[model samples]
Target: GEAMDRRRSCGVADAVCDATDASCTEGAPEVVQTTRLYAGAIGQATAHLAETRLSWESQPRNIAIFLRRATKELIEPFEMLRDWLVSRYGVRIFVDPAAAEELVPGEATWTPEQRPHLADMIDLIITMGGDGTLLFVSSLFERSVPPVVAFNFGSLGFLTTWDFGKFRSSLTRIFEDQSHLNLRRRLHVTVVQFDEGDRPSQVSEYQVLNEVVVDRGSSPYMAGIDAYVDSQYCTTVAADGVILSTPTGSTAYSLSAGGPMVHPAVTGVLFTPISPHSLSFRPVVFPDRSVVRLQLPQSARGDAQVTLDGRVGPTLRPGDCVVVSISAFPLPCVAPLSDTHTWLASLATVLHWNDRRKQESLTSASYTETIAAARRAGEAEQAIDGGAREDGAVFDSSPTASESLDDRKTADRRRGTRRDRDKAAADGTVARSPAVARRPRHRRRAAAMEQAPELACAETIDDIESFMRHA
Candidate 1:
């Protein structure tokens, strides 16, 4: 098994695996405009966002507030922000009912059911939590989501870029329409039911901000599932499950499942298997217009369930399937800037992408000697800047100059090397000789503090599933 472990022909041969998935179909339908968001516990993959600069006319009127929890630590700040928005901008504020069981007196609240009526009424949505908060907001408004400003309060805040400490100033700029926006697209997914006659009925439709997962539930046996691309049978998945991800979800579950890190700006879909049975069955990426379907094989032993984002959905009976495609309505998320660096920034802070320890080249003979040499150089420079050291230490103890060349030639003529040394020895005033010049040290590229982080509270991981349940 160890020798057979390889990435040879990982994904389906015909599967699209473009690193920069920029090309779209010529006949692709026009993309819809809406608010976008990032969601998931560990976060999910994402696609390219439609960039837009906020204008004066685009300023939000009625804003909605969402929180990770309603604890004192979370609610107090919400109150202050709500008061400030109402007094300064005179904007109406609405809150999510889930965030607070009992709303503050006189404060308005909203639910996902009101999205249709409140879509226009709520001009801006502000969420404080991890990326999950943003995804919950996405689930609220299936279509035409208002621009959203997400604050980071979760463990890994890739999607929630802004800091809570600077929320006031950030909101000021946002309200002034000086902020940039990235309109992200979500996966439009539908769970359809099938009867024994092969007739199918739509069970539920959802706009998923992250990846859609279909995996074996609590069953002990590995489930066999069939996959389709553009309605064509592609391959069968024999594993815990399979994932269909949006570009936005590329960072979340898709990444964890060994899928490529498709940029949120690079519009595409990802297919990643979870604990796959076949070694060659690898993750795949498809163009934006591509439609994928995952079905259960009739020979499967048990039922598999679908999980949208991180939330569990309907169960998959033997014949049922899930259809996934690019959503026409893209979510417009408020961004700090309109540049590619934002994606790079997220990778750096969240994933520490490409971060590594730099190697050091020791030009000196030994590490201790190198350290001593550096210390001497620093001391010499300090002595020059100031007066001499308090200890009056000598910089170099070697002779300043060698015996004159003419004198050495005269000595050589008078006597050979040994006799010359004997004459100098007899004279008692030995002629001093110069030492060879030392080679200049190469510039040190690394600092002393540049070291790999030390592990803390290094406990042995007993069991991942049990640990998660307890956590």
Candidate 2:
């Protein structure tokens, strides 16, 4: 079975005949090889502080390192990785001009302008920060992207799977054997600008991994946006903003705005409103093939800002439209050995999906006991009132009617005094006259809290069943 699985994933076009036939190889096909790599890392001072110790072993090879800026402590890891790669595999290391000046002394560097020329020779990408680093690397490539392996060195690591401890083993597996990959879809967005009495022209274009957000920037009034899907008019949204998200982005800002969570395997886009003025403006999911367009109305109170993957893009004036569709190329993300396990673990640890303190049991016996006690108290009060009325009627024509009335008054006074004493004892206060004694505030609050759940659970099973049927 293992042999068959290997042969199936061997990247060969033709099927293997038999193991003994000599043509069928045992492991991955010879076509797979990674000679040049493009490595990126988060160069923030905080990232270096978070990861105090960095150690790894790798063969020397030619690789490019991408970073914005770095501190002295953070530069050590990049230098270490570079030295390891050069010492083991005799690999030459490349870095951006700024990082090259700081970390890789005497090594050649590539500028931002030379990235397109450098992209052709890169075989794979290794990112050493968080999901943001991966997104930044994705933005660099305009065509086909090299497979990326990311390490979790940041707070939220939805994309970064591997840690520094397993970096060597993970890289060895990828370099030496067949590895599974998750193909993440990206969105292509184009902004169209219009001039007075002139045709609309393409102003800007960007490929985003997460989502495209159109929002009312610094505007106190709600944004007025017209939405369309596949050239058909959808609706005009008046809200704080609207998010158009890819499946990869469904768990990002979209999730915060009450959008549904979509599996990475799904190829659909999400349309979710941000604080919509109307409650009926619900989020909608469209097929990947559908083209979505959003335009700011002429009556809009302010200009709307278009952001791709949380980065600032073109600003949309009134009558300007933004078009979004699936891009031709998909990002090839290197999957951890246990894909589902890692994903589920991240959801629990990072996102805290279902993390909460265990709630006290709602259907406790104390609830029923409290309800029964309240009912008994109410019945006893009714009984006392009835007895008093009977006494009054019986003593109406008696010779000793005045004496009987006096006796009843004495009994009522005694009951009131006893009640006051009980209240004083419960409240840890001195016993006082009936006029001065008051009910403890906590008793009333406790009664209300106890009664609330009882009323909620008062429905019968038959009522629940009927409600379910109607629903």
Candidate 3:
């Protein structure tokens, strides 16, 4: 039988046969019941037309590092992903704040100026830590957001779509053919404090990718939250906290709070309560373009905690309010090659979520076994990196001592030259004579080297100059 679609009017008219399929010729066209199907389709089309379109742009060669500062269990997966990225893309990885020291042991001894530029030049940002670490790194970007691929090694990963085992394959797919695969959506938030009359003040704006949670912190009673949708009073929530999450955050704290699981590609926001005292206080999904305003009652007994994504926000006073809306710019994330539905299905399969049999299987995998597997994976990736290079030049620590000494001497000489130039400039003296400028600091050292015929070193001044320049 052919599917028959029907249309109905909300108030003005009755059900009508919108369309018919000849495949069901034996029976009359089935009159389905829906609210103005054609009109709904038209409206949806117009809305999408008005919404900002996204571009799939090319990304530069960049390396991704999985951060693991928030949780201990995340370290194993992070190391695995790091090794895999380095092996496949030849991209250097940087760990989180706490692990950075161990990952680059010599960084502590090096001056800030002498530190390698790779840290700042890292193109891709990946965080294996919880949402907190992801939020922390996102805030680090002053202007533009770098593509961040988060792998959730924590209890929740609403923003993170990939797990440890599948991440390597997903990443390889992204690097193949130099394609950019992530999609990002950002939220524009405005912090507000009303005047004596409750008028909102226009202030600075910020963009977040995950969610913004407002909560009453450490109080005996629930905070009174008054919500408004585009100036229309929505409801008053008597709860410990309220969460406004993006589609990327639907599976995070929002899910724990009883919110519906929304796919990442869905353009909408989820509003869920942390713990609502009333049964009617269920989670609600709003249109992506809707503006949500949250204000605490002036007569409330305590203050509330407001967090953006996971970064800390100012305490919400009784009369303070926050305005949240879809940001003009979205945080572009590289989605693993799999479509959103496939990723969701894989998440269910890997996490053994919502299924008893799968949960039992997940429980069967021991923590120690997982760690061992991660380590083995990392070692294998290192081997891959060792073999990937065309030229077999390997970096060894044998010459490190000599290299450091030479670097120090060269640095000292540069500092001396800079000081001499500054002193001359401050004194308003004329430029140095050519002979003085060309004078060598180690005349005795040069003489000694020249006298040693068996030194196997060049005696030419030009040769010495060339060596110094190269150093």
Candidate 4:
């Protein structure tokens, strides 16, 4: 009874006792009202933007809706953006002509002739689904290019940049025109074959945003492969096959096959060996503009399977060659408007750099401390860069002096040739001025030399001269 009375006096709720009053005693003071902080900044910002007016009439924007075909999970993300846009800017949502009516039904207007093909009508393309969906959308455009923003739904996606937990903030930022753009390289592939009588057949081409691989098609025998770069022999690979991948794809199959993890912004191709016989045959990176060719030996014992991105291509028989080169265009990916270093930082953080033992070494450190350390390191890097600039001034000046010396040499060469021409003209040996002699030098020589041979007669000589002038 004493304990119960004490608990009641203190306004403490006991497990065995039932009470529903602000104060334990009738005359006791009521508890003071207090508020708690809410970590819903993104949610609140998104709601605020939904209610605000959009400036599209004066700003005039083009929008794209990207969704996955297999999962159909991006409907919510798309609808959220769609409703917000209609409520604010009165922007119409366009869909694929064949799939528009059946897939997307809304208050937005559409025209048949002006179908939104992602590559055509839309200024920006939004991808909803996994990395596969992103790849599918990226494969649509052939020549002209547009930017894409991918909301990830795939597992282990290197291409998708958005996090599900922070999507609310990401969406709000994008809608408010506060985001970054990450650029990536793409590869173009062409498939060719011979007709029944050995004549060249029709050509089929594919554009891939990732990689193109050629390997033995589940055959028991090893693939006979020969590779060339710029018509120069690189190597004749005798392995499962070869993978010609872009920097973006280096983290895909290339990485699995012992290739480096290249950043998407890097302009290069990763030539990764897929299960090579030779230990010395390691992966190599070539300049972005290099043209790589893979050929199957005529005496090859097996047929080769070619894969573009993940799709399979026709089997390549002996004597067949696959040519690969970088495309003239690039794929523009949308990201948060942050420092470029953030991408690498995200990879390192998410992947957990160093090793398990090293990570355990820092287990006691707070996350805040780690972040502060990173920031301090960044500042140190800036200071080092400034020092490099100051120290490199003399090194930079040397290049200018070298360039001036080359320019002087060129000028002296020109001046000496002009003086030689002037001296020759004064001696009456070569009467043409330097400028006249320089003009059409080859053409004048050709005109004098191209005359048809004379028949050792005046009449033949006259006819030959006439023919040379006319020719």
CA RMSD of all predictions: 21.2, 18.5, 26.9, 30.9
Clashes of 4: 3
lDDT against the true structure, per candidate, is 0.68, 0.65, 0.58, 0.60
Global local distance difference test of model 3: 0.58
- Badly placed stretches (over 4 Å) of model 1 are 1-49, 56-58, 102-106, 111-113, 361-471
Give the TM-scores of the predictions, in the order they appear: 0.67, 0.63, 0.52, 0.58
Q: Top model by lDDT, which number?
A: 1
Q: Which 10-residue span in candidate 3 carries the lowest summed lDDT? A: 8-17
lDDT of 3 by residue, 124-190 (tens): 5676665666766655543334456666765556456666677767665544432233344556788
Report lDDT (Cα) of residue 321, candidate 3. Answer: 85
Please tell me which predicted candidate would have the highest TM-score against the true structure: 1
Residue 453 in model 1: lDDT? 18
Q: Residue 122 in candidate 4 has what lDDT?
A: 61
lDDT sort, best first: 1, 2, 4, 3
